[model samples]
Target chain A: MNLARTTSTTKGKECEAVPSDGKPGAVGVDPEQLWLRPTEPRRGRRPSFSREAITAAAVTLADAEGLEVVTMRRVAAEVGAGVMSLYSYAPDKETLLELMVDHVSGELTVTDPPSGDWRADLKTVAHLQRAHMLRHPWLPAALTTRRVPGPNTLAFLEHVLAVLRPTGLDGAAKLEVFAQLTAFVAGHVGHEIAQAAVSRSPDRAAAEGRYLAAVAADGSHPELAEALSAPGRPLTPEATFTRFLNRLIDGLDTD
Target chain B: MNLARTTSTTKGKECEAVPSDGKPGAVGVDPEQLWLRPTEPRRGRRPSFSREAITAAAVTLADAEGLEVVTMRRVAAEVGAGVMSLYSYAPDKETLLELMVDHVSGELTVTDPPSGDWRADLKTVAHLQRAHMLRHPWLPAALTTRRVPGPNTLAFLEHVLAVLRPTGLDGAAKLEVFAQLTAFVAGHVGHEIAQAAVSRSPDRAAAEGRYLAAVAADGSHPELAEALSAPGRPLTPEATFTRFLNRLIDGLDTD
Candidate 1:
């Protein structure tokens, strides 16, 4: 995460991929290389591995280990291919990342057409995204870096656009809305994941609860204390997601 | 980056930190150890550095470089102290991260009292947060981990709670609202930072534009093509942030 990579109008998180040389790559990928370039299979004798198989292996690795461990060598080894051979399939770790992203995105099957109630449909979209990210725990992080939608991701985006069709937003606003919604879901889910981990330990949860209690007892934090003491609805993760998602999608104004 | 750590209620992204010993620390930190634990000044001599100084040095390193480089050794070196001495200030990188978060959070000063219009004031808070993240690009990543608020973070949270006071929300909901808003801002700014880096490279931007055009040209993605072709408002980052923030805060329901 070389936060120092700066240019005019710069926005977003730094690239997650660390180069083998142990240096951060320039903040973003070459679009032509990532999107425009076509993958060609070897024309010689039949290749031992397919890009799909390689990408699946990489996804499995990330799903099992984490994104950082999805190096070409490990991915190639997982697929029983030579390290050099993997390049024909994924060129570089960054490219593999693109593949890994698209691979998991296939799970987001938009079987139901948009219900035409765009807000409800958008809520469903958020729910699906939350579930999808839950399944692929690395997804929220993967999406944070600069990504070009592959076929699967583009398909999902198309579905979201369809859901927003009634909003009468211009093409760009629709795109922006989709991007915003996805970011909101990812952010919520990421925090949810972290907090869930903390809650798993009774000691830690108790400690946090106690700490909040103590803070509330202290006179300076009257608002915080009052809030904690107030009776509240059960904030199951799903319920929390629904509340926030409604605030976002229902409040959206095409104008 | 450990995407694999799972439990019964496992939902989203995994832990960002990997323990050196290849074991997950018993979930979360004890609140007492984190907040209430007193730092005993070394007996031998007057300490040359304050906790504030060490945290500031770490924040500087993260701001200039990135979060990955703000190690104990490097932070100590930056502060002109021995590596061992740094531990007296920050027991570990996690503690240092908590400190770094609070340190940068000091910038979120709420000088103006909350306006009677809570929605508008909440928008201001979001705007302040977005600007803060832009200044410290490392903040979004830092926020993803489980953080215990230090003095600075709590002060800001207290201000947010005060802003939400008119909403008639009990204490927990106010806290939830604050957390949700912060996460949203961090998520948006993180993406904004990433996108800004991509826009810096005209070649890459053009390639992305062209690729989208080609995708839109293809018959399969009609909604996508239509959306892309539509004349849209100029999406300046600030404008985008305001648009989304309004949807979130305005749609917020206290009941």
Candidate 2:
């Protein structure tokens, strides 16, 4: 579902904020500058650190300590570069975030081309994303914020687009499918991590179980009570993911 | 899909953090206490502010200034209560957040019981959730953290269970369907809000467009190029939500 509504109130504000460049809502880095421009050092003394090195350090920091710890100063320190030198490459935290996302996206290499069974291939794409996001728990949050794909991210996107090629859906539908799939994976992974954290404590687990049981015993919630009373399956996260993913992809329509 | 994996590495730290009370993550209000026990003021004197009034103030502050500003001090000031006094009801920010989520959930009143067409009814539930989250931009993030359905939240969950009753799925599946649906809505609305914010800036929009155009022209990205070159439809958020929701719900298999 397209949850983004183009309401009149929002449109009014957008109109006033639109810059005079005849470009509407083009507020972030110019894609031309980000994607096409070379990251050459200024014509001066030799550069101390590469953009790739800085981004790798940031990603490493985020993986260990979460995204909040990956500040410009901290990232510079992580790579043993001066903050000023770091700015020459990323300019700001936002740019660094973009760089970090793409740097990690290099991990998403598709060894097999689309299997012609686009639905099956799409599921594989989603599985890869779920695993990737699990490895980088902060990714779901990073992704929800605005980002323009760097070369590595674009490469993964290209692979996804190829996976959807045989579906015969128009380009827009294909793009929407990919976006929806990614959102789904991110959302699921985020929930999974939170749940995992809670599930670790037996005391917490027992308390939660008791609470639900008590709720079921309460007469007012018949349906809830019934549902709680039924036998449950393995309820493993992977199984749950597979079940939900199958429903989502299988239900996709080309028209 | 269940995105949360049970990674053993995380478990070691969690075990250490488990509290001695045999109720580790029971750091939040005990569900039994919250859902069942009354919030009676201490025996000696009357409470200066009702829990509802305090929660309402928190919700109002959140709706206006966003969640970050709805701290205990700010919320206490908003309701003209002392910070210490506010603690009598919601002991901390997490508790206040639980109250706020349920406080707003009072808006989700399902007038009709679920129609026999479970899929159609489930879609309706999702639409309601999407609209609800769009109204409160901070809600998606709040939901991601943690929340046990206080009375208001439980009421909505009860209705969702009723709606899923005819699916012939067991209770666990029904609960899962509801959880997945909520997660999907939160994820979509969160992305929608971010996109809308970016769309308001002409420079950012133009930059993003140019980046895509450049990518389309680059020969390595044939599938992406084809997708980018293809003519697009209205691409409104509501339409997109409906399309994706249909895919998700329609694809759901009970087995």
Candidate 3:
């Protein structure tokens, strides 16, 4: 497949505007080229590798290592392809990330139809998302940026819209609900993951505890000091997520 | 400042465990060394620059550019210091990021005490954070990772903890609420910024519209089609934020 042919329409001027460094304002993947275009090069001799194979390789690398390590060079090495050849499929890391995000989103398979209870169904959707983000720890950060919904993402979104059907929300409102719910979950899960990491490192956790203790004792933060002194029962990450999720979802008003 | 002397205690085996690529689960900045330790290197002759100057330089670079551009080398150049000398202040980009987050947080000065209404006060806090994040677009992403609180952050946190004092919640729960609120604001601002970027690029926006239209036209996505067709009044990002923030905050139960 001709790489230039695939992305040339949206690649030239617009690409310059889009920082390829994976920041929030970067132009998203061109949906038509990425999701609608043919996976194989139309006019060229068949390449040995598939786009699916490359995306999978990148996802595996991200899952095992981190997003930073899944660079074009590293992903190509993982898939036994030349770095130049990888660009034919994914022009840059940004495009690759879009593919990776949509690829993992395929796992969000919902067989059950909306149970007619919008609040309950929405909560279920959030739980599914929370679990999914935990599985792909990089997702919360990746999602902070805009991603044009690929086929898999669109399919999952369809389910969410259907679940929200009972809310009688207009198209935009329903969409906003989904986006807000997603951002909320992403925020919660990111914090949860970071907190879990702190827990995993005893020394780091201890250092933090001591530091906070010192801060609490500083007299200037009397409230903090009191809060620390009268600590309450600890909640698991899941419990905390559920508590916050219920608040956000249940507070949603159809009117 | 002697970088080795400051960091040696936490830098050896533990540093290996932490991925320095700015992912969650990377050991956070040590609060004692980073915040409590004197800014000046105690043993060595005074360096040409102070840690405050280096942090300010990096913040300026990040404000104009993005976080990805704020490398140790770039920040050093910005401050007119050698990269090696820059290490004395911030050993790595991660540490610099922690500094930047705390530095900008100083802008979040709440002169008026909490208005006794915990919910109203919390809403004010969220609004303040939203404004703060908008000023420094890099903040939303930076906060995704754990940052040990420096003096400025602690001061802001002290104010927030005081606001939550009226909630009658214990210390741990109060702390969790602040963390959750901060995360929520970061997530919302990130989405808002990405959406704004898309709107700024007419070509990208048109392409996206065309792509979504094609998807909506496809018979499989009937709900999406209906929603897009009946798109109601579009809420401004601020309106949307306030709506969701109200839902999250109003639904918080003291129990």
Candidate 4:
């Protein structure tokens, strides 16, 4: 929505106070309305309710109890406000998630600026994207982002694009490369995080372990069994991120 | 789980007799149990519930209702059986899902197997992987597969490793490449599927239309905006998938 105008209910006679029934909600200058920050808030004061506060609360709930528990009323209550008040900022739970997506996206650092080497540059960018998603595992489930690339996301895309520019690929190819590269990194990280959550369940993990032992008992799939048994090198998003980047770069730029 | 020792209650029934229970539970078969037919009161039977049947039912649920809804009770309902009885075949829902994962992975076909041309071979394998995930969007979400690859998954990996065989990369390097490639392909498909789901949402589609209108108003972030608005080509998983595979291949393989 129109994000330019933010409202901050007046500070009243008591400092550090927010009026429940006061003026328009606190909004900020974030025009994308990406974080669902209030539309009109003056400096040095807290709004009665805010998108950031709600999302933070939701994130906490999700991290602790899993995503299924992060409902609208629950998040609203967490923020010490009514569902209606929370709605004033997030409008709906899905919208609140979108805001959360942008909020988490903002945590990634673009760089002092992207370096010029397309290969090195891309590796760096991939690592950062992985790091961003890892910090907010809830983000992987928010796979379908609308065309609204928030400020932070815009920056991330720009930085990657900048790195690719020096590689000598034209806009169309570059766009395709960038899109594929990102999809790989994002998809990979999402799998890892979600899998970890599922595996963390004792019943599930135990069952999986037994199944593995049973299946491998006959050694029918030796390569497979060895793979299953290997104390494998742990792959964070960064390493997998880099490896995929290499694969993509190696696959592209025959020039 | 005593997988091999499992038995199907459908055996030993007479050909023309009506089912005794009238509850219409699936005649589940643990073929490993070798209880091909029950004794005494054998009757005519409907199709039996194998792990594959349960897995297919689970996949169908996930495809239609999203992953969260694919619970044990729901899957049992779909299979026309009691929830507790599912443990005989699936042990737990996670194992059931693992069965589903392997079952779905079984759908992938790498026809020529892997060739010495690692780049070309990997490219071929990559496309097959992409196609499989694309067909089943819920797959990438649940394919947690940590150490032991399932039967179908292991075959796929074995095939992938064979492709890397000619790359002259060592075990660790080959493993990394394999992991990276799978992650990349899986991750990319995950995004595409997630986005497809998003576009399917009326509210999101409406919000997106609004977001696009806003973007048009601002007339900034030209590349981002262009990428969003351009009608250059159909936005399909196939197009992006191929592009990404090429990019990764180009980025790797200095040989």
Best by DockQ: 3
lDDT of 1 by residue, A109-159 (tens): 789998889988888888999999888777877776768787788889999
Instruction: Estimate how well candidate 2 is docked, as a DockQ score.
Output: 0.33
Kindly list the per-residue Cα lDDT of model 4 for residues A1-255, writing each as its tens digit.
343223323211222221222111111112234422344544564557655677678877766665667787788788889776765565446556665665666676465665666777777777777776676655555543333456556556756666766665555556666666666666677656645643555444565556655665665545445555653555554555565566666556624
Residue A206 in model 4: lDDT: 60
Compute the lDDT of residue A24 as modeled in candidate 2.
18
The complex in candidate 4 yields a DockQ of 0.16
Report how far off residue B229 is in candidate 4 (Å). Answer: 7.3
**How many collisions per candidate?**
13, 22, 3, 48
Q: Worst lDDT window (10 residues) for model 3 chain A?
A: A1-10
Per-model DockQ: 0.37, 0.33, 0.53, 0.16
**Chain A: TM-score in each candidate?**
0.80, 0.81, 0.89, 0.70
- Distance from true location, Cα of B77 in model 1, Å: 3.8
Instruction: lDDT winner between 1 and 4, please give it.
Output: 1
TM-score against truth, every candidate:
0.85, 0.83, 0.91, 0.69
Residue lDDT tens for model 3, A1-255: 211222321223334444444443656667666666643435555566767888899999888777778888899999999987877666667888988998899999799999999899999999999999999998988888789988788888999999999888999999998888898999999999888888887877887888888777767778778888998998788988999899998899997
Name the lDDT value of residue B44 in candidate 4: 67
Ranking by lDDT: 3, 1, 2, 4
Q: Which stretches of candidate 1 lie over 4 Å from their true place?
A: A1-26, A39-41, A44-46, A65-77, A81-88, B1-29, B68-74, B82-85
- Which should have the higher lDDT, number 3 or number 4? 3
